[model samples]
Target: MTTIKDVAKKAGVSVATVSRFLNDSGYVSLEAAKAVTSAVEELKYESNPVARSLNTKKSNLVGLILPDITNPFFPELARAVEDVGLTYGYTVVLCNSDEDPEKEKNYIETLKKKYIAGFIVTSNQLDAPHYANAKVPIVALDRTINEKIPIVSSNNAGAIMGTNALLERGCRNILFLRGPEKLNPANDRYEGFLEAIRNSDAHYQVVTCPFHFADSQKIVENVLKDHPQIDGIFASSDVSAAGALKAAGIVGKHVPDELQIVGFDGVAMGEMLSPGLTTVAQDVYKMGAIAARVLIKRIENKEIEQNFYEVPVKLVIRGTTREGME
Candidate 1:
């Protein structure tokens, strides 16, 4: 409830100086900054963000726009991004686009009008020039937007190594259950699957799903019924992998003997599932951290490089793809 005027009186400085110091702009000399800090402690003056936003045209917030918040992968990434943003003294505003380009456009405009400090855009939609004039720094996550915008994502091409690991274990006839090409992650992973299949003598093909759990389940159930010869699967997500496993059971097929599965995104469900799905774990934590750091750097004018960052990926071979498999 203490006012800036009160702090100024105690510190023997003008209220404008206190306001500028609190907003992290309008540099103050070392001695004056020290006095302002001391006075802030003595009076406990809390600056109201609402008033500051009106004056400085900023909300002191970083917008985190994701394609699907319901997906375990994105929420995990969001948590990491929030943590990183907190470290840099910014609050994160979460928005779910649900893979809708229109909704994403609206959210971008809304956040732009709100004057968020920056943006961490993680979308499944293609980049649009509508946001080219968007103020503040924007760092894309998990996919590229435009050549002008920077993207930080996992080494999607490296999934071939994981798929090859499964093939090396004597599993041929691998099935790739992926989402639509509209999603860049799915496209990159599908290309990686192709690379692995082409390099090995193993046979593989892809099946497209709607990228939702219910649709993936229903579609995979039909696929399993038709192709009873499938021995292994590389799913674009943990959800699809789970769907595949559930369908295999309903069809009375035991996993790894009749069917082996490897999922993407080491979501909690991956480890908790029966047979514990083998998956390639995207370094989501590092992705989030790097996105946050880079966005902040650009905001502070310290970011020298404008390029794509490909984070590392690791194959988590679990109970699903065990030793002694066919």
Candidate 2:
């Protein structure tokens, strides 16, 4: 393999000049930089990241920890994180904690030892002591973490608008399909749902389940049997909403007539369902981008105006909820 020495020799410049040009550190004359660039291209010299990291005291690596890789929501979020990290010239390392607190802590500890520049976490646990005590900058994605670290999330309060839309469509009683109550986002969504129907004549019920499509489907199926009067549903996630849709079919309930449903996350798969899912659409991609941007700034010792950022959300009307119902 061609080394920096070969490039320096070919460019007729000192090794120090070549190093400066390669790392973009300190300063090298424009002429010297051009010569080094040309020589590097000709020699196809690849910089040794290990050596460079040793000198700079940091690596161009960032860690992204998510609760479950099986969830569709996380995959989309992870894709956005990777794309944004690449644009900033950083490589992202993904870790799936599987909702295990011990696994999450272990991954954080391992990544820190590898000199990862920063972290973006969507933790399943309520407490994040590992992240709190981390040496590098850390940012929360989707879920809020400790107060010291920054958080990027969707507008939880805006979920009320989606619930209200269901009520406007003549749904008398609504069911809120949510995740664990301990999760910050789930709790916020539950609060928003209650606030939307507080003064309305319609009644509401809550059903907590794991964030798996199959598990949610089973819970929803049983709920429909137990409470046949439920006329509408507001699922905290698109996956759960999809499951609700399936349960409705299994129970022989006519969608948009006997029952209406709306979901969150605005995932593209929502449109592919037989009756497209109406939802409170949060920009998951934008959330990931903002998290990466904020974490990068912190890693570079740049000042950010705010530690908490909420990406906007909007209600999307679709076939699942009655159209033109006011």
Candidate 3:
């Protein structure tokens, strides 16, 4: 295989100059850059990434650590991150921690040894000290770690709009299928729901559930069975909404007629569900893209305008909710 030394010889430049030009590190004269480019093209030279990483103490690899891959929301976010990383000539390495802090720590440690360029994390370990001291660029996605870390997320307070839509439809008794209490987004959403119902005449109850369909389905089924008067539901996630829909079907409550439902996270699975899910639609793709971009910029030592990026969200009316009744 052709080597940097050979390229230097062909370009009439020292190996150090060629290395500087290739890495875009130290400044190189225009003439030297032109000669190196020509020589690289002519020789079809491909630098060894492993060696380059070792030499520079960094790799062109970005790590995306997600809490749960089974959730459709995360897969969509992963795709966005991967696409943006490719455009910036970086490869994305996906890690599924299953919301396990230990597993997440292991991944972070392993990647750090490899000199990963940066990370985009969606973790539930908000108080984990690993992130604060990782000594690497990291952008939190869909979750908040700490104020010091940069974050890219949706407007979690958008849940208020969804709750209001239910009230507008004359839902007197609403059930909120809340997510894990430890998650910042879940707390924000619950707070939004509470704010929307604070002065409303509607009766409401909150139940915590994991962001899992089966678990949510079981809890919702029991709640709906015991509280037959519950006519509306605001689920913390599309997965939970699907579970609520399933539970409603089992409990013989016809959606949008006897019951109305609104889900968060405008995941594609929501659109595929029968009757579809009325939901608070967050631009998840944009969140992932922005998080990746921010992490990449930080890794490259570029200035970022802000530390927090909150993408806007809107409530999407669908078959799950009564329309034209508000």
lDDT of each: 0.81, 0.87, 0.92
Better of 2 and 3 by lDDT: 3
Residue-level lDDT for 33 in candidate 2: 87
Q: Which lDDT tens digits does candidate 3 get at residues 1-326?
A: 99999999999999999999998889999999999999999999999999999888999999999977777888878988999999999999989998898999999999999999988899888788888889999999866777878989799999899999999999999999889888889999999999999969889999999888999999999998899999999999998999999999999999989999999999888888888999999998899899988988999899999999999998888899988776
lDDT, model 1, position 209: 75
* Residue-level lDDT tens digits of model 1 in 151-193: 8989887679768867877877888897787788888988898
Could you tell me which 10 consecutive residues in candidate 1 have the lowest summed lDDT?
A: 124-133
Which pairs of residues collide in candidate 1? none
Error of model 3, residue 50, in angstroms = 1.4
- lDDT tens readout by residue for model 2, 80-191: 8899889988999989887788998898888877888999989856676887788889999766667788989899887789889998899888898877777888888888
For model 1 the TM-score comes to 0.89
User: Which whole-number lDDT from 0 to 100 does residue 57 have in model 2?
Assistant: 61
Candidate 2 lDDT at 256 equals 81
Clashing residue pairs, backbone N/CA/C < 3 A, model 2 = none
The lDDT-based order of candidates, best leading, equals 3, 2, 1
